[model samples]
Target: MSQRSYRTAIVGTGAIATAHARAVRAATDRADLVAAVDIDVDRARAFAETWGVPRSFASLSELLLEEKVDVVHICTPPQQHAGLAIECLAAGVTAVVEKPPTLSLAELDELVAAESRSTAHMATIFQHRFGSGAVRLRRMAAEGELGRPLLATCDTQWYRDEAYFAVPWRGKWENEGGGPTMGHGIHQFDLLLSVLGPWEEVTAVAARRARPTETEDVSMALVTFESGVVASVVNSVVSPRETSVLRFDYENATVELEHLYGYTDKNWTVTPAPGHDGLVDRWAADTVSVPSGHDAQLAAVYDALDAGEAPPVTLAETRRTMEFVAALYASAFTGERVRCGQIGADSPFAKRMDGTGTPWGKVTAQ
Candidate 1:
């Protein structure tokens, strides 16, 4: 709110907290890193020292009460996101929280309610949406270059060893929500819903082949979009090589995105269909392409903030994503097809998981 740049505070000092620190430091004149916080004082001090931040706090209340923070980057895990973000909003500090914004739809709904009652600018940190390929795909879809998207597919394959789950909250349902689907696959899931619009229904099944958790290690779903497009989502934490890809089949041609950190070409292959030469010609004539990524989206955030407009990834947009995950979980639990936009605040799935222990421990090593 000051011309002196947006004073910022990062509320968690884990690995992601460091990345947010770098992002804050990397932000242009639009934002500044003012402080860092963690429940662990030493960790907070280490992050503050590393980032050259002048302030450190053991809790959000201390930072809110002491720091002149305009924005808060919530780098905590999913279960911790809702409360901190609500506090930040109530403190009149804008917030950019990490993805899978909350552990359940109910938590997310409460967050939305809190944000609605506040004037703070709130957004989810879906950095993948800021990536170049994602931006391009969204633009094409908007311009109708991808006409009446008929089919969509997402494949996310990443490995997570036993040690990766050693963290106290890593594999538990109450803390982490679900395994790959809710934790790792969340970004891709958000991107998919963003580019493809809303899903009409989802039928999913999950497996625990790799990790020891009540949550699934591998999962796949058939998503039917409201536009009559059918999509498949494949998420796993035990693939040999990491790969995240999205493919869309439209009336005129096919569009694909390779979701890597620094994607260069962001290839969009346009092949004229049997009788759709005119559509191909139109795309060839009007389509303008460029290299894009998280930087592009981040720039958009700064611009929106400067212009006093809402951030592109608003709470409303993210709520649908939470619903998507909620539906997937509901479908998995009830063994029935789950419809989107139907889970209510009083839904049984609203409650947190048992958080007892990792489900992968149940099976002996092969």
Candidate 2:
């Protein structure tokens, strides 16, 4: 890294912001949390005092002008990501934005464009990619040790109540982008795309089985990878208990990662394809380990800075992830198979956030 310490500012003081701060402190010898900003001045000040930040700002603009920060960790909600990230880029500050990045593909594109025009590098937090188990799976798949891939599946089910939706923008399409799909599902969906490669097409169905929100609590999508491997993704906020799982079926072997913190694989199964018992045995002998979600990603960022290279997760990759999200929405809404590249400029879901008052099940598909 540069000899000078990196002056860092956290722009949101929520629970996740605290997690990011701790991760930063653990990961970077050269990074210092100089400021914390929140719309609520009292919360900002409290966070600053607790975290030992030198300053706190009531507004991001104030923080940008006064804090002299070199990097910003944006922990704001999904709706606020685009505007704040764009503003930071415009002001010549590199930023690490929270996941989902924005509520729509159009906003994601604008942020990408802004980053390209600025000297400051930008990245999104797809922290699951940093897990050692995830890395091993990707590596094994790439090395063809798993042989031809047949199919993949991701299941994410978690519980959230009306109280959770009491947060002002939690249920709104304009704010959260969608309920479980963008919020709960994006994590594993991003991981799936990371391991399986780019998606070719998608068709989906969604519903609000229980949550009192304006977005779906349950959604299922059929995705086809560019390599012709098919996958099924299921996301839900109505399950009694929380669980996340990913399974991969290959011609030579079947691999699986099933864990509560889906990112960390404490349990894995690799079934050998007939004569490939040796390969499976070798993989089984090799251990997989990694820091938890936030820590691993932060450490990776520190490493990139140390090596004078871009962060592990780039804006282009984030944009592609967002496009996948857009295609899911398109498929869910239109009841037709939508191609990945087709979710470009003219896509209906682009910049279209109809925050109608009706709950998810009541809103007719457009």
Candidate 3:
């Protein structure tokens, strides 16, 4: 790794921004949190003071002109991701953007095109993939030690009330994208896809359920992967007993993780089949504890940059995950199965997630 310390800045002083600040600070030997930016100048100043960042700005333009930053962490809402990431790429600075990296596939394509022309690249914050248990599971699957994957389930059942959607951008199709499926469940499902590989087809259904929002409060889908693994996915903001759960049932054993948000090694459990009990020793031996969060991911990101390699959760990987999201929405809205690469430039879902407008009537109330 190069010994050079990366100068980093964070945009958006929201709740997630504090996590980014801490992650940057945690990697202090390799990165310096030089600046913080937010549309609210007071929040920006307060964030900088709290994080001990040297500077604060009200806009990306001001931050870029004033400081020489090597990397930018974009903690802004879904709608602003593409524009801000594009700006960072154009300025020859790497961008580490939050989940639901762009509002739509078309916007993501624009960011991808911008990255191709610049030395800088963009990585989405799919922090679950950085966890040690997830990494080990992925490695085992790749090595065939986990045996043939058969069935898997990913559930992101969390409750969000009217107060949560009271925020201006919380529930709109144009701003926050599509409720729980896009924002909440993307984390667990991204980890699922990382293990299962490419998905082939998806059939889904969505409903407004209990939330007062323009987007669906709950969605369920059946996903068929190229590896012959069939997975059931549920994304919801209406569940009273909130949990983020993923279970993979392979021929040899069943690997499962049960956690609300972030998870450590303790959150994972393995149940080997009758003849595969020996696999337990292997799992126990490879115990490297790393939780799923921005700190773990940011450390890996800086390390990749130092080695002149594409960071984890590259734009291509993120694109696949986002496309899967679009496919889910398309399938749910149109009542038809959507396949991989089916939603392209001409597809309605590509342009907008609500897809030819919501079939269940538009949400008038906030």
Candidate 4:
């Protein structure tokens, strides 16, 4: 903790690991990219070379043995996240895991249990919440500048063809963790939860409708937040016109965000209600132009780590977001509304998102 700059290692050599490395590189004052690890050593070395990392190893244990790292970026698949993160956490290395953080709530709980006994911590990558637009929105709402949030809509609609799921992990229940809702829509809905606070209940429906995947490719939910705000949520990978959108209708204004993947201040639109026009100028001044990406979030993470505090997207918050995902699936499959804290350790949904034993029945990969 006394180090001026943390030594960071990336524990996966996939496409997203490059982003993690670059984010670390961007904040040279707080962190240094020291190593890369992958089961595939060749890929790990190439990744290390591209990122100017000093070391590469075939496994995290090897990397830990060879280098003293303060932080680890877990950019591996959903199935491998908990194992790598648990190992890193036990070694007192803060782990920044990519989402869907685990394949099941049980697995995520294992991570929480590991962190409970470790000096270090684990944070999930929900970078959408770090964007300037999102920050401004939350600030405005908190200060009552946006008035009481009434209704909202969260949508993550994009296209991923059959070929895209050809990868062993892309569209499987056990691997990717339940299609678009779990992998893709999670970012948007997490942003919604960030803005609206605790969600009270969810009534959802999911369908395999088009994708040849074992899990649902499309899902819709009605989320009721604790504050009585109702949100319409949709996660789809079948839409050809790709877009991620969230709209908040407040007593004083209507604020919206629309972008494909990541977003910035420009992607936001704010409109004040009648006689509340002062918010127009305030909104513009409030937006400071930080884009939503790994870099913005990592800067905050290091800031917390340097202060010996837990990082952003704390596991408690992560559990809340993840719990909503489980509840949505439970509701979808059970044909019943799910409420906050309803999926206990005894519930099957707590064990797996598809724990209701396949909603539509007998879905096989085509």
List ranges where model 2 is wrong by over 4 Å: 1-4, 284-288, 353-366
Candidate lDDT scores, in order, read: 0.76, 0.82, 0.92, 0.90
Determine the C-alpha RMSD for candidate 4 after optimal superposition of all C-alphas: 1.7
Question: Could you give candidate 1's per-residue lDDT for residues 1-366 as a string of tens digits?
Answer: 433478888888887776676666666676778888899999999989988888899999999988778888898877899899999989888888887788877788788889889878688877767655566667777897667888889888888888888888887777888788888887777888988887899998777886766678888899999889999998898997888777888887777767543354434455655776675455445444444443455556667777787676788998788788878777766677989766766677665422222224344432
lDDT of 2 by residue, 1-366 (tens): 455467899998998898889987875666888899999999999999988888889888998877688789999888898899999999988889997788887888898799889878788888888888778888988998888889999998888888999999897787888878898888888988998898899998777787777787888999999899999999998888888888899988888877665445566678888898887667766675774488888777766766777676888788778887777777777777989788657656776532222234454554
Whole-model lDDT, model 4: 0.90
Error of 1 at 360 (Å): 9.3
lDDT string for model 3 (74-130, tens) is 999889999999999999999999988998988999988999998998999999999
lDDT of model 4, residue 363: 42
Worst 10 residues of 3 by lDDT: 357-366
TM-score of predicted structure 4? 0.97
Q: How accurate is candidate 2 locally (lDDT)?
A: 0.82
Greater lDDT among 2 and 4 belongs to 4
Worst 10-residue lDDT window for candidate 2 reads 353-362
In model 1, the Cα lDDT at residue 361 comes to: 38
Candidate 4, superposed: residue stretches over 4 Å from native: 1-3, 363-366
What is the lDDT, from 0 to 100, of the residue 162 in candidate 2?
A: 88
Task: Kindly state the number of residue pairs that clash in model 1.
Answer: 11
